[model samples]
Target: MKGNWLLLIGAYFSAVFYSTAFCVVTLHVDPESHYLEGGKEGTLEIWLEGVQNSEEVFEFTINVSTNNEDVFEITDKVLVVGSIKSKVPYTTHKAGNALISFEQVSGHHDNADNGTIVSDVGDVYAHIYVIRSQPLNVFNIIVGWIYFTAWSMSFYPQLYENITRRSVVGLNFDFLSFNMLGYIVYSIFNVGLYWIPKVQDEYRDEHPGQLIPVKLNDVFFSLHGGLLTAITIGTCFIYERGNQSVSWICRVSISIGLTYILTLAIISSTDKFPNCTWWHFVSWISYIKLIVTVVKYCPQAYMNYSRQSTTGWSIGNVLLDLTGGICSLLQAFLIAYNSDDWPSLIANPVKFGLGILTIIFDAVFMVQHYILYADAHYSKSGRFLSGGGSKKGYKKIHDSEKGSSENSNFFRT
Candidate 1:
């Protein structure tokens, strides 16, 4: 019992560490990864990366204002990243400072030009407007919410099964604990920003008309953080007491950790935080470690599977996995169409990949349900029939030896 409690504690902390690691790798993005454009500015050649390296030209109307409240304007037609043959000049605006805004030409690519900003001393601020080259939509939020609901709904049956069995037979407390801790850390990340009421006010005032900036990775990580926390708490209850199902629970945990967790972490970390050198290094190392841990425990999972005579997969978990998967898939597609978010999703593929795995697991779980829970005598037929002609005959005496013999075979085999 003491050992079990110790393991449980260990699992909880492990979950915390891994979840934090997962959130960081998946969500953290470096602002420095974007291009900066503020130096001595003559003709600020603003050229965005275009399809096939071809040039797309945009026209801009420049504005300048001084601390002394003097305002001046200029109209210039420029081809970005390409040389200007002729310079168009109006009354040269006083060198105090300048603001440039570029609107795309009508009836071409729907993409527009982000404005370049110049400091009072003619220094370039490398103003980045991530809004160019994309269409905006509400589908991302909608799909994300759907996925959230599905994953959340998965906990019920798992909770019921664990309670009914009076043990965490087919669940893994350690794995779930780590998963939950990750979600908790993630959910709280952007919470600090909310306390600064000024930020909210400023954001609302300047959004769209002004510079509305956000980190894509951070939001997704926060979402995952909350989801995992709920999963962790539910898993803890499932394994609260060691009972007839402990072995199978451990096995299922190992299976999930192997089939999904490691790959999910690796792909997301690499894709989302590629700009963070330290994060990149740590993420790769964690990925390798997680894979190793899962592999090392594969035999243990197999043993439990054999003894349990079931897949040890939970319906609730499968439902969550399936729901999360569909939601994530839609999220990926939605993100893919936008230029700003495309980088983040492409940078971190864990959400996308794990979503796929969850779907596969959902399919397997249905099979497990029919073969195991729905048909209890399915796997035990060979053993039961060798001794007696009827399952009822074995049930009477087997009831007396049920807990011990089953438990013993789990370890001996």
Candidate 2:
């Protein structure tokens, strides 16, 4: 029985290690990156970058076919930027990298349901390697699906341990709860997006043009998986941090970030975009909170660097985060690659800029995590507290003799 119990514990932690390491890559969520504006006639501009001049970009073809009505006609297909006469109603020529724009018929902007049809415009317009519905992007989809499944499966053991222990000694409650709530809300909202009448109508209208309904998968990744993993890890972190001000700050920051992003998404779902108001101010403030989090966590990152340790950090979690970041970058490439696919009436440069930022930060975070683990001091099981609760528990472990002796006493007790 003792041996069986030991085996189970070993298996459980092993699963945890693997799951956490591959968190982002495995549980990729779709972030909403596209938005639609209703009008009698409207235009969208998609700007493509990182492409060679006069290159035969097979991905540059903008296919727009609608089963509903062929009533619409392009007013101007070619945008005369510099000397290039691209397409009209859709244009391939614009200044800077390359610009693509589309013109839609007036008074037919939205479907019967009247809900906004927004997706990650970046993913749709960009010429990144990963195509949203293309068969070629199956690897990304498969990788993401596997990641999510693994994450969900791994949750059980940690949950069991938490239940048996009753107290989450190393858990961070605030971080966990806020992210849990955020992800839950995000998941439910995504499902709601499917059932919402406006969304359905919009999808029906855009059928053949863009099959999938407006969902968050475009911007961030997978709503359900990302939220679940984030919340789970966050809960552990909050519980571990206890009631310190730092804990409270984390909770508030996460809460604000979740609230701001979710609120913007909700507003974007409506016919009219929720313009700047007090809530908008709050949203921008929340954006700052995210920056603060990165800065605040600098010390933790520094500690990991100084000690050359991925000790207290979960390699599994960091790995997941890195994978998620890569996925986001892929999404960005898709958006920025073909800028001419969208209409000019509803394009926002700020959104694109922010998308760029997300990719950059994600890359940095992932590299840092890898660096920490590559160090000589990197341990398989992160720096977690022993169950004995001794005063020396917080002391860093470096010697095998001290570790073995402590382990013997711990098992003996």
Residue-wise lDDT of candidate 2 within 196-220, one digit each (tens)?
A: 5654444434442233433444223
lDDT of each model, Cα atoms only? 0.41, 0.38
- Evaluated against the true structure, the overall lDDT of model 1 is 0.41
**Model 1 alpha-carbon drift over 4 Å, by segment:** 1-136, 177-240, 243-304, 308-313, 337-345, 349-351, 371-374, 377-413
Off by over 4 Å in 2: 1-178, 181-185, 198-223, 226-246, 251-309, 331-413
Most TM-score-accurate candidate: 1
Task: Give one digit per residue, the lDDT tens place, for model 1 in 1-413.
Answer: 99999999999999976553332111010121222122221333343321221232333333332222222334544433222232433232222223344443321222434322211212112222222222233556677777776765665666566555544433543444444434443333333233335444434343322332334444554565466447545544434322333345445644664555445546645656534332233333334333332332243234334443332335666667677777777767655544233555656565455456556656655554555334343222112111222324322223322323333222222
lDDT of 1 at 197: 51
lDDT of candidate 1 at residue 295, scale 0 to 100: 35
lDDT of 2: 0.38
Q: Looking at model 2, which ten-residue stretch has the lowest summed lDDT?
A: 23-32
